[model samples]
Target: MLFLVAALLLLGVAMGSVAHAPLPVSLVAAAVIGVWLVVFTVRERHSRRHSS
Candidate 1:
């Protein structure tokens, strides 16, 4: 699932570049995804700690 997301993101960036998406739009996408990843990591760690 993570690999799929990453592959899709790369595909989106490539297609967006080919189709002329604005730079800020791409930056914002990356930023949002970055935040999501950080949050997910934190939650996963917290959950693992509680489980063990």
Candidate 2:
């Protein structure tokens, strides 16, 4: 799906940026990515449940 692709692209960009960033910056970016993934998962599950 488009949303999934967009999420993956964003994740890739974040990871790439993190690779060149300082340790503290990398950590914060990692945390934000983690939270984004969690939110995406929850939304996907909720949408599926309701659609079914």
Top candidate on lDDT is 2
Clashing pairs in 1: none
lDDT of 2 by residue, 1-52 (tens): 9999999999899778878899998888779989999999999999999999
Candidate 1: stretches off by over 4 Å: 1-19
Task: Give one digit per residue, the lDDT tens place, for model 1 in 8-52.
Answer: 999998887846868888788779989999999999999999999
Poorly placed runs, candidate 2 (over 4 Å): 1-16
Clashing pairs in 2: none
Model 2, clash count? 0
Model 2 TM-score is 0.64
> What is the alpha-carbon lDDT of model 1 when measured against the actual structure?
0.90
